[model samples]
Target: MDPKSVRYISECFVQPQYAPEESKQPFYLSPWDLAMFSVHYIQKGLLFTKPPPADEQENFIGGLLDRLKSSLSLTLVHFYPLSGRLSTRKEENPPTYLVFVDCNNSPGAKFIHAALDMTVSDILSPTYVPVVVQSFFDHDRALNHDGHTRPLLSIQVTELIDGVFIGCSLNHAIGDGTSFWNFFKAWSEIFQAHGNEACISQPPVHKRWFPDGYGPIINLPFTHQDEFVIRYEAPQLIERIFHFTSESIAKIKARANSEYNTKKISSFQSLSALVWRSITRVRRLPPETTTSCRLAINNRSRMEPPLSPDYFGNAIQTVRGIATAGELQEHDLGWAAWKLHEAVLNHTDKKVRGFVDEWLQSPFIYQLGQFFDPLSVMMGSSPRFNKYGNEFGLGKAVALRSGYANKFDGKVSSYPGREGGGSIDLEVCLPEASMHALESDGEFMASVSSSN
Candidate 1:
């Protein structure tokens, strides 16, 4: 790691405003709420990067931290109505805790990995109120080893990769993915332009913004009846990338659209449809089983005047499309595409916003789980892939992959710049056998080769 670089590490914490026993009411955190929290956490990861110089690192990190500390001050407040049961507030504000990890004693990679492992464990098992911030220097001899071999993020210096991997393990009760990424991008731009007097102007905050109702609220109907409650059950999904050129994607979209006699479909829509069909074919679930597809949507625009991209808050919502197993089995790809699009459109309405508000105001809010399983397909689109720009004053990044692992039953993401082109990069998580089968298929094989 460059000695001149300074690392910025931070974590977010949720302070339970009300104790459950005092209220004597059943309160639960919804999966959507958990997702909202996730957005903030993920953004933390995105905003972090290696500073330019060893000497400037500390200053950069310190300045960025100071800015964030000030901006997040509103979120740090005591609770009201302390006797009520703990539930998510429409305006639940959580504090973002930050600490600087010292990498002086070990290689940066090792230090980061150790820090991440420690941080994740700590967040998973908080024992105190408001969550204390922990900071430390790595003193282990393991720093002498090859840092690249480790799973942690690291910086290489003098053929010896020694640096810190600034990380955070935030509680999943604050924001979802979109919210997280927005905050991250803001942080990155903030740090990058640190010391530039004009850049010091803080972005506007929109607390009243919420997710537009574009997708089906699958959990709503179930939660209302007091039947099967949705819980966070980590699905068995894996994330992997499938490379394809813009031309190939265009061909696929054209082919599908021609067959269905529909308007042009987006890369995301087409790929999502493909994966949805493929997963159904592989799972062979019972004919009676109902499968739903859900997608995460950004709600920054839903707010009045729009939430600033740099607004360090959760600004995401999810939409779902459901169909019976029989429908999926009998419907063509066009049908699936239409359904998915419909779901997307439905969630974008003002009425959906009302639904979220009503749901939050429900009596059985706490009974809901932090995670929801929707036949579990996860997809993140258009991850900026200007790898050539990541030259770091060196050459372009030879390869880049979002370090996202598929933890659900179905996961797919479309990234940019595959093999250096304007093509849409795809990562699909399916059974290894299914991947192999797709690879063996002549058309798929041809597409893959052409993409390369």
Candidate 2:
């Protein structure tokens, strides 16, 4: 429960003037972007020390608004596609949509300011981090796959008793996790530099790439025109951030590799296996049922010549590892981890090319493993994304979080733990019943620590 909620103050439109060079233009949506239409926004942010005295707070916030607005516009001059909307042709067999970055017509990103009574710890330290994270977002409209007329990005600033929260909500169709962070990093540089254009390290490359013969995947029996609306019922789910120290991770890796009789087991695979096995056991799923785990893989390096790290678009695809509940229950942790390792190993250049070729032929390939699949779980986001390192004038973030939309059952995202020694923190969301059961499951609780 959000024992306390963020008080909505005021909201305003932050329209960064799209550079004049960029006229009305349409950016193509890659199959990768299309597949991300229904998922939650890539909500990430940093917590900073509270504002100065009231007079200073006003000056601080006003100065921030000015710098953010102008710097963002300058940022958009380079990453213009982000300042536009998704235009769709519903008449097409399987509705086609193109990203529009028309500066004149686009309503630049939305910005809002709000406040809450709780400090950072109030939100970060809970067994299930509270859903109040969403109170910080002005998620203007429903989320959907079709490229509709909606702001491509939204930013929110929230004041706490002793800290500030900067939340960014970017449309999933425009980019993947890497692209999302890249935009933030670039924008932050400009803001911290006091709007110095010279501060931008690498201007983003907004052009999207795809193989020839690319077309939308039509008639996805599953691709109904689904609209994602936010409905808040009393909390029926749990959201918990669990930290596993380097020592624990090392032990898990050792056990996994020893069990596999090889040094091939990776930290990710070992951790995923541990989490999957733990959650599966605590949930007490039927043994005969088959379950799957989905891993979001970045395809940038997998491409033949490799896409530039600066390629700012959705460059990710999901890889799935599956087994029977019986197998997961019966296998040793290493065996379970091996399954995940094998999936990672399967992501070869050839395999990635085949995927791109397949997407070229079929546009609507969505790997939304069964939504809330009782027998399945997924691990997204990379531990490599050091969210806590993102900073403005304020010090490094004391904590970071995903939006409250993360309450979907069986969904988990991993972040690089702030301790900096190859540690891992997981934001795990599961059903209310399963989460309660998880709290009491000794094995699952054995390695989890309260780092926030």
Candidate 3:
């Protein structure tokens, strides 16, 4: 194999002899389950300022692989009574297959571009190995007519543009976005530590324990109670970057507070409200038309004991808020802000937890699909300062954006300090016409640019 060719690995686990009895209902892995599952699928693409001399490139990859082999292990959890059990947590032992690929012949930029087009389904097939290769291309050459530059992951080479893009398409049912990032951060930390003299210990691991008797249940809506539930399809969501100053965000927050007669409004509240209003305007839906927005609120605190960073499972719960399209548009920004904030707060309350626990415990878990449809808009806020400066030691990232989650129709994320000094960078994905309508609205534009 060419030293620079990508390598692929696959691994599998057999069911454990002694396991818990499986439940007779369908079960979904939490966010933590997804994160732990991802640790086994780590693929790092390191871009150098310039490619090393030909003699050194082979040695580099070999060394990296050796390091990885020594540092990782797989664990499996099993639940038995295999048939007709919906709530059964089956065995989840990590597989033994590990595959690698090399695209030394192609430029790194080209390789990454090609990889992006490969979806999760394509990557996980039994026929193809989990690795790929391509050459890196010049950043300027990839720009669209609109002057927006694509975020390319490239490996820099001297004679030719040599870059490597590495990816692992994980199952979404196992975890949410926050859980995914956490795993990536941990992987990065481990990779960096291998090259340094300082020893960095692995993140702590949590046992495979679920809430007591927390099997699947269903809830019902009067009108749709009898309908058979179908799998929800992930909507086509796009990602775009928006630049705003800290000052602009502050001004908007202040205005929101004044309008609502509330003591304060957060930056997230202000921006989300503006986006909500802008979306309604562009959709040309009346203010009174019913629409719902869902915000992903991290539920790390809600567990009886907080989950550790190394816990390696999904640890998020979403909170939903509903309003008429007109209510969001005609009301002052503060009103929307307050409602969004309250929706989040309400989910965290003990009563809410009790309610969710009861609902999940009841026969209603299986029927939840019949009663509630997924939200129209999905918005998330990354931990502010951590996103922009993700310096895997190559200097700060020039751009940061969220990945497209398969389930949401519209998605938005906030990145801090892209425009300098506490300013937030926004990324939104919607129909092109909707975007155009938002750009032309004066109040919407001003609110986004204002810093309270």
Candidate 2 regions with alpha-carbon error over 4 angstroms: 1-3, 17-23, 51-58, 90-103, 144-147, 213-235, 365-372
Q: What tens-digit string does per-residue lDDT give for candidate 1 at 309-387? A: 5443345556666777678768776677777777776665474556666654552233212344445456654444232
Q: What do the candidate models score in CA lDDT, each in turn?
A: 0.40, 0.72, 0.42
- lDDT, residue 197, model 3: 20
lDDT of 3 by residue, 1-452 (tens): 55333333322212222232332223434313322221111112222222346335655434443443222111111111111111212222431211111111111111112213332233223221222312212222121110111111212221213322333222222334454454445434544565332233434343433455642221222223122223333343333456677777788888888999987678777777777766766778766677766676666555556655444344555565678877776688888888877887677547435655554444222222232343345566553435443334334444342222222345665556544677776666665566667667888776555321
Ranking by lDDT, best first? 2, 3, 1
Over the full model, what C-alpha lDDT does candidate 1 score relative to the true structure? 0.40
Q: State TM-scores per candidate.
A: 0.55, 0.89, 0.60
Q: What is the lDDT of residue 382 in candidate 3?
A: 58
Q: What is the lDDT of residue 315 in candidate 1?
A: 53
Q: Provide backbone clash counts, one per model.
A: 38, 3, 76
Clashes of 1: 38
Cα displacement (Å) at residue 94, model 1 = 22
